[model samples]
Target: MSQLDTAWPAGRDVPDVEKLIRQTREQEQQPVCAYIYDLVALRERAHRCVNSLPDECKLFYAVKANPDPQLIASLLPIVKGFEAASIGEIRTIRGVSGDVPIIFGGPGKKDAEIEEALERDVMLIHAESLHEVQRIGWIAERRQQRVSILLRINLRRTLPEASITMSGRPTQFGIDEIQVPEAIRLVQSLPFVQLEGFHMHSLSNNLDARLHAQMVATYLQCVQGWMQEYALSIRYLNAGGGFGISYTEPERRFEWNDFMEELHQVWEDYHIPGIQLIFEPGRYIVAHCGYYATEVIDLKTNHDQHYAIVRGGTHHFRLPVSWQHNQPFEVIAVDDWPYPFPRTEWRQTTITIAGELCTPKDVLAHEVDVEQLRIGDILLFHIAGAYGWTISHHDFLSHPHPHFYYINGT
Candidate 1:
């Protein structure tokens, strides 16, 4: 098959994922299909995120997104802490760094998870419901240890436009706004549960930076009002991260520089001396650092539509199918055709890339126009670091797992 040109971001001196894919193909004896990560890019992104934030703002990586040990370790020095959604995540963070802070947050926390979080001495446990608060208080009282927590509030305000809305509606995530007073009263009565602040994480996969700044403003205002009305001395405002990475349009990204400037203005206008702002972002911090490279196993045309079937499918990387969007990809033409038969190829045609699964829904990219592709070509899906492997149904077809490699930063 003929070689195809790959597009790189203009004027950005970043180590490209294409180079890594090529290197993997050359080294692997078998057909190369793996999830490769660039530690250099991950570290650079983490450093940029930390440096751009206001002095009062702290960046925390939510471990639910790409909990690979190496990825977590690479980000340890730059990020202030980690936001773990489960006990397993807490353990994962601890396995990487024993001293690094961890905040446990998620709905439907079992008693065992709470006990483990307390044992680990996590920085904060985001209490989602009144029952959870009481459970924590009970556990802490039984253990005779005072524990600090932030109440996850599902605010009544309408959320900004986002791919997923976790709050501002009836959801299993956090406590409703109307019940905050009752929760606070319950917390006050509990001897061991100390209310540190509020955790208002409302959105997921949000792309608009301006809207994010406005959301931050609203959170700060709501917290300020609560502080005044209840005579409460809050210490932290955990605005859970919803920063997005564009899978459809790579150029259309979250404007971090502009958002940071606006965040600084918000801090200056609503400056609270002791209250610290926490942002636990999972997808944005590591999404661009990962790439999933799958070699084309077969090429064909069905009813005038071109199709490229890869060795891996939604079982290995499910983001595109999960979000129902065309995942951005680039074709790397491999000229080595060992077969005696002539290699068939498609030129300047739209192709639907699917996996070797029984169901027809195992599509990665649906009808994406490509310059050229062939049976031996490799399609590298970018921005796949977070929510790719962990969220996939790996054992659905009992297919062999994909290889994983990390490119250590030079």
Candidate 2:
């Protein structure tokens, strides 16, 4: 059974969700750009789960999914910590929040990045591999400071549509589960190093809350078993985030209650004393809160195929290209076109949505249904708040980036 069946809220329908969307859209100012306040709502939902849990669990907002300064600034106070993938992201978090606990994630860490993280006094550094552990130690030794580190574990699990595979057969992230013993020995040998916990991030959307809970259970089991053998206990458990969001249909919702219930059950089954659970949620919190607004430049028809060429393309929102998923977009006339409703059979045709860029692969939607799209219309793509800004965009295209705005309060 899929996780959503058990984790989502019960008896909720699309109409209730649509009302919320329509209300937000009506009050929003135009040219409506991406807004990230929906992330706050998601955080609230996650907090419900965190608060209900028996153990001490902390949620860390992963900055890689959507690193808007304003979004991060708002979430810092609510969340326990922040997970940073790069030095720039670390800096961004530091600028907005002072001494907010941060976990330095990502595969490769340059010496300078490690030094900077050290200088900032980040709470934890998640070492992706043995080399990274030694490198961090070297940097920490140079700075005369001890660094608390977590060894990321490769669980040998496969995920669908993952760009970079981190487990199963020769993955590039963390030490293999088999290598944990050696990793522990290596950490024990270093006098200036402190081994805090084990970290694992498996791919999952909010829709698959049960799977997320199961993965977390597996991670805790492994760590607990290892600790039992070594007569040691970790202070933290970092279960990395892969919470999914609805990009195609805004009405399709995630069942958070069921997801949290499953998570609570898993933790209850394997209760560990004094180990704080840490979650790094990046996309689930921010994806729905954002939208990408573009102006329809022109419309053309060829061989019964209609095309709406917009000012923005894969350069602006990369999910259509990277994930091969359709984003829900509404085409409204910039200035209302005068038309009367005809009492005839209206036919919906499939059209290819293309971006303004020169690349042929810049197609946004291959086949979408619309009611007679015309020139000078505006298209607003929904649920583009996460992984939309940085995936397929290249500055070489030379097109100006889309302006970003946020709904101030709600």
For TM-score, the strongest prediction is 1
Worst 10 residues of 1 by lDDT: 1-10
lDDT of 2: 0.72
Error of 1 at 280 (Å): 0.6
- Candidate 1, residues 227-317, lDDT tens digits: the string is 8888898799999999877888866777777677778888888877799999999998888788888999999888998889998999999
User: Alpha carbon lDDT of residue 6, candidate 2?
Assistant: 28
lDDT of 1: 0.87
Which residue pairs does candidate 2 place in steric collision? 6-258, 7-258, 7-259, 8-255, 205-244, 206-244
lDDT of 2 by residue, 1-410 (tens): 11233233211232333344445445655323332234444455445535655558788888998888888876876788899999999999999987899999889889999999889889999988888888888777777899999999887654333333455557677788788888898888887789999888755464555666777788888889889997775799888777666656545545565567788888889868899888887776677566666756667777887777887788878888887877777665444333464222123757788988887788878888887565545576666777888675647479767666555434
State residue 309's C-alpha deviation in candidate 2, in Å: 0.7
Question: What local lDDT does model 1 show for residue 17?
Answer: 61
- Full-model lDDT for every candidate: 0.87, 0.72
Q: How good is model 1 by TM-score? A: 0.95
